[model samples]
Target: MELPVGGHPADKYQNPKTMKTRVIILLAIFLSAFALLPDRVIKGTVTDGSHTPIAGVNVSIQGGGSGTVTDRAGRFAIRVPNLARALVFKKTGYKSLTMPVTSDSVLNVALTQATLKTEELADQILDHSKQPGQAEKSLAFNRVAAAPATFSGAVMQMQVPTESYKPINENGFLSVGQQPVTTFSVDVDRAAYSNVRRFLNSGQMPPEDAVRIEEMINYFDYNYPQPAGEHPLAITTETTDSPWNPGLKLVHIGLQAKTVSTENLPASNLVFLIDVSGSMSDPNKLPLLKQAFKLLVDQLRAEDKISLVAYAGSAGLVLPPTAGSEKKVIKDALDKLEAGGSTAGGEGIELAYGLAKKHFLPKGNNRVILATDGDFNVGISNESELQKLIEEKRKAGIFLSVMGFGMGNYKDSHVETLADKGNGNYAYIDNIQEARKEFVQEFGGTLFTIAKDVKIQIEFNPAHVQAYRLIGYENRALRNDEFNDDQKDAGDMGSGHTVTAIYEIVPKGVQTSYIGTTEALKYQQNHVRATGDSDEMMTVKVRYKKPDSEKSILFDLPVKAATLAFEKCSENLRFASAVAEFGLLLRGSEYKGKATYADVIQRARAAFGKDEEGYRSEFVQLVKTAQSLDGSQETARK
Candidate 1:
């Protein structure tokens, strides 16, 4: 052992107290010197050798776990201990680089591409195929596995929408003899269509929950005969051979709300509840929201009124209840908006509802149009709380319409809950074209409610059908007992909007693993269909309340079991079926029997009647895009 720093070896032996004091002084001096060293932040951009931003690159201090991945912009900032000797940058498909930490804080790194091992390539393929919870171990491996991709030297990190979706449990075959009735709300919201489009356009399969077949089918216009009766909607049914599965029959139900002329529509009272959070700063978010709202503004009549409520870390009334006549003023207020601060969605909701109540308009089109990416971070951020808030406020007679924008960190579940509870409709705007479709082309259907608490119940006859399954609507299913309960809430139907629902039925004696049979009842006898009763396959019952009423009106339609050849079905039904098949394929659903892109394209093309709007053609193109992504060559169009 060496003598204490401040004393000689003889001093320690002669005087222990002097030696101890010298040691304490020396320790203090050493610590003070170390404390004086500068704490530094290393900030820089990571790129490929080609000088393009490389997102998702991992940057770390050597010998430490402290690290961060580059943002979508390929920028990163990390705090390093003063003693850190070097910084390391790494990513897949690129050479890992470690450099000494010099006096400079900014270190721009350009990584070279490198060849990956066979194991690495297999791991990447496996990672892509594994579902969220199923790949925990694989994901853990991937974190430490620095492999190369076939992609270019620099890959821009795409903004991933962290939208939550509950996996859809496809309706199971129910024994008509035991349980004949199936009931669900009539959902007209078209959010799923655009949401699915967003994923496919980005070259990814959509989350299963995002592919609601009914919504995708309803997203397009269907030519159904208008209602001439006292009812506000016309109910039509078409039965045909299942195009995807030869073993089953497809039942299509269509509901078309009565169209009211724009001039005849009621005066409007609107509240634009806009989110201006830091998350909305993306070009596709706040800026796009402004553009969309401007379109709605242009559609407003002189009799209409508008209110603007903006929220960030807090909520504020930006423009209070301005008349539609002052379009310039409303547009100016929207143009001046900027995105910053954390999201306070709950606060914003409360304030928006407060404003709507303060300027309550009876017998007018009173509604609140909420524009957001659904990032409710600051207050009442969870689904249940937001649902309760909307549920309570909906009783105030102001309907809500939710428009979701942007991608990253989107709270889809919260928005869905809010719309469902608030007597509203939800639509996701992925691009300006979708915005135009919602705000301009389908303005009335997007904003004006024609019927509330719309419910559909189907009672299948045991003699005609053995088992049946209602396609999609997993999240919208309601108890059979709740169908007639006027107090029970269901979905709303907007003016001129069309809703479609399909049921796959296994006729009596047909075999299917989708549903199982129960033993004969010992307690009760199965009812035998009398003479002509066997011809009726099912009875469809619809219950709906007028927009402002509490009592619901009931209507029934008897569907004959007669099955049409797939080729003989109406063009509308064929197209809708094609869309449903595509949705199933995207979801990777177990129920997607024989639903090939080729089949869907063929059916859609054949049914692409009167394509003046070019929507059907666009759909064909989208299907091709999805096919290419799925690694299939496009078959020649007939």
Candidate 2:
């Protein structure tokens, strides 16, 4: 303090006391200036143009290097230094936004994804063409359209690629005299119904591959008798005139699993494996998924514990195992989730399985609830890879359940594969009401498995049935030898789940166009059934395993040659047949003979007994909507 660097000697000495006072004044001024420039906690959510939360967005005060990136929920809380007039939000694929900071505590921002100008897109395509093997990738971004676009007028509907489904090859009628037995796995999935409903509600016909008639019929609740004995399920069979083809008889086989009380349900260790990728930024995806999970949270018992794992570019555990009683804490974590980045679904699955394994509960319901649009692009994206991954994880005794969300780019084939291979059930959640139906009203059926590897084998009586064809389940048919193989995987049946399968059968003497005739085989002789079994239509054999067992138990039911008229059939049978007919019409099936929307409506209405829950009523209305969309006559063939 002898002499300041830039000060005179006289100035240093003459102001010993005065200089001290001046220094105090200067210190006070600096302290006051520092006090005026206080730090503020700026908190906000970053979303895209669709108002979907966007993660990994860079948020910072203007002219400041210090900033924070948004978490998976698109929320950020950063302390900003003084003299910052505005906040800038930046992300690579989105347009950078500089918003005025009117409030120190809160600022919600919406950013738009950066779309290339026509010229820019053209340049990118041109450049990509010069590079080897890049043409397809470039064209995917700028594909040819059916019509010229007026870009300034309205936003054109973008063509999002979807997984291709194999064409539906209708099951052919097998000769009862030649091949008396038909074996197939039971399918309890209801994705086809909800997905078809989505298309119809949007005034578009669903693709043929999307219309699984068996699933559509099974989607509705049938008042089938519950199991009265030791078996976990009850089987019932009924026959009536086929609504589409009157020449053939519709055989309805129903299996209803026994219901368990909520108190009796085992403690559940659930992992909510959610996809928070950019593709899930749509309202119907991540947002709807949140609401759906909230409903599920409400149904959780106090003993249940839940952990949440989110995946975007990579997977991360957003929340640790939280007691169901700490619902507020769980929901708060859920609320913080935001959608952005590429999808890494495979990583998410591995992480979810890891958590499920770590928290494995003996005799407890250990499961993972996967909610996604099925856009697994980043790591291990292909179906085979995913199936193998799930297959390996399934051996750990942890079950999985997939809830599909969103449209356009939905990967039904992928999600369906995961569910089928993972020993889980697949369902599509089209709306909040559907969510309530799955998570609240049918929670036990959707979450608790009572039977696994449920297979159905029917031995037709040659004396009664001339030929037979399963109406749907084209993808679920199993080889006769595989039906008894415990190692061969099949569909699972959940508690209180009702599965209905229909077969259009031709009586021994009846004539039909579906009958396939073949020359007599020289290598083998076909033995005709004796007349003593003339009254037996077929024998329904069901094989299933306990939830924890490897060996299967078998049950049998003998169906008679029922001649019940369509009008004389039970409401359950009639309604299920009507649904099958609707599916045929939707598919424009080759066998849809004399099927009209009017007839479908009439049959559905007549069978809409006890319209509790209004599900049947909704079906009737959906039929009317389809009628309006396709006209009075069936335009499905169009």
- Model 2: residues with Cα > 4 Å off, grouped in runs: 1-166, 520-526, 529-533, 632-638
User: How many residue-pair clashes does candidate 1 contain?
Assistant: 2
For model 2, residues 141-232, the per-residue Cα lDDT tens digits are 21121111112212222222343445678887888767879999888899899888776654345667878888898888989998999899
lDDT of 2 at 471: 91
| TM-score of every prediction relative to native | 0.75, 0.75
Q: Name the TM-score of candidate 1.
A: 0.75
Question: What are the lDDT figures for the candidates, one per model?
Answer: 0.79, 0.80
Stretches of candidate 1 exceeding 4 Å from the true structure: 1-161, 522-526, 531-533, 632-638
lDDT of 1 by residue, 168-227 (tens): 787777887678789999898888888876665444446666678888888889988888
What are the per-model numbers of colliding residue pairs?
2, 4
Clashing residue pairs found in predicted model 2: 72-338, 73-336, 73-337, 73-338
- The all-Cα superposition gives candidate 2 an RMSD in Å to the true structure of 11.4
